[model samples]
Target: MRVRNRKGAPEMMAANTQYVVENPEAFKGKWAEKFGNDHPIHIEVGSGKGAFITGMAERHPDINYIAIDMQLTVLSYALDKVLEMNLSNVQLLHVDGSSLTNYFADGEVALVYLNFSDPWPKTRHEKRRLTYKDFLKTYETILVPHGKVHFKTDNRGLFEYSLASMSQYGMTLQQVWLDLHADTDFAGKNVMTEYEAKFSSKGQVIYRVEAQF
Candidate 1:
């Protein structure tokens, strides 16, 4: 699905330099200083809107959250929500997920979230998948020892592919849910993204997995 580009999105992002990082690469290995504390940093790669990342920051005050997206228009939406909530623990980064290593040093990030990422279903595009082995290696590089990745998606094929990719990369799967909403025990533990809420409302099954590297 193509996101409608919003007018003034670039200006909006430019005005909010405090919450929107202008030069993320300059802060490599120094994210704790950027957050002004050593709180565990959790990032949502391909964070579509402000929903999941901002919600997580609100729930976990001790954890710093960074929302990364390549689309400036989409990131502007997230910026609006962060400012509306006056969340000090959240930051927005306008960068591609594939360049994560350029912005973070080894053991800098504690956790990662891949929510409803593009499947890149074409056989020739498999390497573009977030769960691809090379991408997994990048995640592994920035993640702390035993750091985990939490992934959610409505697409069955992508979920299956991600599961296999993570397993092949020697990641330990901590939890797997074929129908997350059907699990009564998972209530209150899951934070629904904009896409997750929309798809799940249509009676679509949500798949989730937690894998540790």
Candidate 2:
């Protein structure tokens, strides 16, 4: 999805400085200190437009959430939602996923959410996929021992590739749902992202999985 450049997006993003972390690298090892609690931290990679992460933070106030995205335009939209909701447990970061380890310490993250990430649907671009082994290694480095990754996607090719990639990286997979909306167990429990709601409404099946390392 190509995002149209929002005029004055950088200024808008800067104005919401309270919700967006200015120096995430400075809080690398002491994330809990920033949150003023010892609650477990959950991070969502590519948290475009903030629907899922904000909803999760609102639902699970006991857990801390950091929503990361690389684009300022998209991230500003997410930050706006968080501010509108007056959510204290959620923070937004305009950072690339490849440099995630720089903003988090080893064993600092409890759970990771990868919701509807780019498929990068090409043989040569496999390495760019978030679920690729290299990115999985990065996740493992920042994740606590036994930390789990909750992933959802409407793209069949990406979901299938992710399952195989995670398995190859020695992650124990569980709670596999090939058709998430049709699953009674997740009814009313699943928080849909903007992309997710759009895709599922059109009769596309959503695939989800939990992988623990």
Candidate 3:
């Protein structure tokens, strides 16, 4: 993950969202039961500040969402958005994404969203990268047949690695685009995460792809 020199964000972000879960054990199973996690779940791993997940949840009411992020400050903002919107489909969690098995059952999720995931630019930190092969296998277990992982990143190396990892896992690349922002619809549809806003503003081209599970 590339650490920004700017550690904090706007005051609106903190005021925009609130922290919903402090612990995962008591809430995970019950929430899953309430929403029937087995029913077409789409998750956003490391959903920063919640704009994308909230927008997605609002758009797709039929599919349930379980958005996970490790940062309390960030998750707080996301939870508040869901609560403020009175959206029933979106669920927020503060947990280590690498420990996904603890919450989701086999063939539970329908899709995994990797929006601008940590680049882990250094070679030594490849394992820490979310799109690593180990993480793909974990996703495979949770997703049903034809389930997919929708990945979008501005980092070229991570995009290449993710594509290779997905292929190595026998997952098909259903669609891919090197310059997602070049597409008018994708660019106009601004689901404003702090990082997404910053990266795009700097004129970085976004890379996106969907891998079938």
Candidate 4:
């Protein structure tokens, strides 16, 4: 997941500011107003390259989407994809996931997505994982009652750790698919991220889970 520094990445992001919100904090508690609709807001943390978010937005026009990624280089690519699609229901933000609550009000989000997020393999960095207990607490603060987190990963170790962490945190685990593509109920409806497509093509088992608070 090492991203190469693309020259003029910042400038490119700035040029595409129409789709990329420069100050996401300004939209706190007013995301529906910002979208000019009362549609539910769904956010994708670490939305690398925008494939999944953009696709979801396209397919589900009734829902508004905000794709957040910290790296300007990677986010710029996502911005380009949004612009290319001319999608009205989707927006991009260059921000860290750990500080998500700062830009979103309590219960402002209906659902959050974590697709192929960095696993943070080292035991010392467990807290940095997106599905860690601390991060799940942060998500709980922003989500409404019964709000859910839909997570998918290609790594088994990370998936197992996330299942245990979410359960331990007292979140309600609803649905789980140890091999998503092999699950008939979800495979057809599931939208593939860039990583998911690549990994699944190589016969990797994708794990998915839904947890509610």
Residue pairs with clashing backbones, model 4: none
Pick by lDDT: 2 or 4, better one: 2
User: What Cα-based lDDT does every candidate model obtain?
Assistant: 0.94, 0.93, 0.77, 0.91
Q: What is the TM-score of each candidate against the true structure?
A: 0.98, 0.98, 0.83, 0.97
Ranking by TM-score: 1, 2, 4, 3
Q: TM-score for model 2?
A: 0.98
Candidate 1 lDDT over residue span 119-149, tens digit each: 9999999999999999999999999998999
By descending lDDT, how would the candidates be arranged? 1, 2, 4, 3
lDDT of 4 by residue, 170-191 (tens): 9889999988898886756899
Name model 3 segments beyond 4 Å from true.
Answer: 1-32, 36-39, 185-192
Question: Residue by residue across 100-200, what tens digits does model 2's lDDT show?
Answer: 99999999999999999999999999999999999999999999998999999999999999999999999999878999999887787999999999999
Q: How would you encode candidate 3's per-residue C-alpha lDDT over 1-213 as one tens digit per residue? A: 433323443343344333344455554445557565545678899998888899888877888887898776676667668878998887777689999888777776788999988888899999888888899888888787778898888889899988998898898999898988787776665455667778889998888898897
Candidate 4 off by > 4 Å: none
Please give the lDDT score for candidate 3: 0.77
Most lDDT-accurate candidate:
1
Residue 138, candidate 2: Cα error in Å is 0.6
Checking candidate 2 for backbone clashes, the offending pairs are none
